[model samples]
Target: MAKKETVWRGLIAACGLFLILLTVSIGVFLCYKGLGTFTLYKHSVWEFLFSSNWNPADDFQGGGQVGAAIFIVGSVSICLLALLIATPFSLAAAIFMAVISPRVSNRLLQPAVEIFVGIPSVVYGWVGLTVLVPLIQKIFNLQYGYSVLAGGIVLAVMIFPTITSVSADSIRNIPLQYQEAAYGLGSTRWQVIRRVLVPAARPGILTGVILGLARAFGEALAVAMVIGKMKAFPTGILSPTNNLTAAIASDMGGAADGGEYNIALWTMALLLLVISFAFILIVRKISSKGVRER
Candidate 1:
């Protein structure tokens, strides 16, 4: 039995080491390929970051202006907007599930949320393209429905289940003693929830919010279906724009290997990986704070 246990433990350790190596290899490869735009082709890093010219396919020599500021701005704006749109609704639903109606939530809402999560991204994109786009156009009386607003709405819906599920679990995990103490102190239901449960669950709630924002940021297909994919910064929420993921998805396939365009797209992917790392770090920081508070 001890021999069998040792063998199993060693196998588990090997699997863990393999995963770590695989992850590091992927990051290293991305960094190497992504740096080619500046290291090999001698493009100005500042120009690539701040300029909005983005004409990488203008010549066969793999030379063109490749400013990515517009895409960066688009990505930030749409993801933030989606977070803004989704957070309040998701939190409220979470509160309703964990605080007000756990039985009903378990029987109905949880299953519904899980079902929405299981739905395909492409289906969401297609629905946004067909239904939501036209609605936005009609509501705003615009020439076209494709805009940042449409993208935000689609991303909001896509991320809703994630935020709601996480938040509900967090709230549900809070100690019943907290609620009982609040009530013993003459606190009303709303007061107990607002002042006790929410404060205790802040870290988990924030983690959920960040995770939802990450999902929104990484979402490409749904946003691309609605967003106009214009190579310019949006003037307003209703304006058309393109983002890093959309641009990479739209251009990467046709871009020649070892070309400026291909390298630039890789750079955008590197930026995304960096963004994901930042979110993970934030989650860790928040979790540590929560632990210290406890």
Candidate 2:
């Protein structure tokens, strides 16, 4: 029995170590390849990051004019919009499931949400392309509906399930004693939920929001289909835009391997890695603060 326990413990430790090694390996590779862009192409790192122009054709003859500022802005703006649209709905659904109507949630809403999660991202893109695009265009009286707003709407729908599921689980896990104590103090259900449950579950809810943000930031195909791949800084939510992930997805295949164009894509990938790492660090800090408060 002791031997079996030892084996299981070793297996778990190995798995954890492997994951850490894999993440570190990926970060190292991105750093190496991304820095190669500046060295191999003689491109200014400042220009590559700050300039809005992204014409790779100039780099073919050693001009090195590639830039990603517009893409970065697009990525941030779309993700912010998606979060704004998704948060209220997700929190409301979570509250309903874990607080107001557990029976309904268990019987129907949770299953429906689970099924929504299984649906492919491409399907969401297609739906946006076929349905939401025309609707937006008609409503806004635009020549086309492919814009940052469309991308944000599609991303919101795609990430809604993740945020809702995680938040609901967090709320459900709050101790019954807290709820009973609130009630004993003559608090109503809404009061207890708003004051006690939400405050207690805030850390977990923030985790879910961060996960949703990560998903929104990394998504490519769905966003690409809806957001017209304009390489300029977006003027507004209704303006056409392109994100870093979409730029990589749409342009990488055509770029010459080991060429300046390919190297620029690697640089964009590095930026994505850095952004995701920052988000993880933020989560860690918030979690630690929550633990201290508890």
Candidate 3:
């Protein structure tokens, strides 16, 4: 039995090592493809990143360009818009379920939230296209089905569950005595929440916002459905736009045959990795301060 256990442990370790190696291999492959865009025929990295034009037919020798700032602006704007729409709603929902009405913790409300979380993003897109788009058009009198406003709204719905679940867990983890102390101080429910509970849970709340932003930034299918997938700089909240992820995902199939187009797609993926890493670093910095305070 001892020998069998040893063998099994070794097998598990080997599998883990293989998984780690596979992940590293993929990162290296992506890096290789990414560096291809830095070559002689390729546009300067700054020009590629800051330029708003994306004409694949234009060659370096032919004086053509592929600017990505427009896509970055669209993605960042969408993320901020989703954060604005989702933050208050998710935080309020989380606090209500966690502290205000603990009775609803495992009841119908909980299950409904789980159901919302389980619904696929594609379904959200379909609903947005079929329902929200028409509603917005009638209300705002828009000419088109695809617009940044519609995309932001759809992304808000997609990321709402993520924020709420994380925030609720954070609030729930706080000791009961925290609330008791507020009550002992003659604080009303709203006052306790506003002054004590919410402040104490700010770190978690910020994390939820970060998660929601990350989700909104990387969301492809839902946004692509309503964002009009245009490659140009967005003119307004009601105008069509495409995010970094959507641009790459939408164009990769045709570009996969190998050329500057393929290299550009990989470069976009690298940009996304850098952006996500930067956000995570910010999260870590916030977490460190919270640790110091504690």
Tens-digit per-residue lDDT, 195-253, candidate 1: 99999999999999999998888988888889999988899999999999999898889
User: Candidate 2 — which residues are off by over 4 angstroms?
Assistant: 57-61
Pitting candidate 1 against candidate 2, the one with the higher TM-score is 1
Global lDDT of each candidate: 0.91, 0.91, 0.81
Q: How many clashing residue pairs appear in each of the predictions shown? A: 0, 0, 1
Q: Rank the candidates by TM-score, best first.
A: 1, 2, 3
Q: How far is 207's C-alpha from truth in model 1 (Å)? A: 0.4
Give the CA lDDT, 0 to 100, for residue 199 in model 1: 92
* Cα lDDT, model 1, residue 66: 78
lDDT tens digits, residues 241-266, model 2?
Answer: 99999999988898887777888898
Number of clashes found in candidate 1: 0
Q: Which candidate would rank higher by TM-score, 1 or 3? A: 1
Q: Which candidate leads in TM-score?
A: 1
Looking at model 2, residue 195 earns an lDDT score of 98
Candidate 1, poorest ten consecutive residues by summed lDDT: 56-65
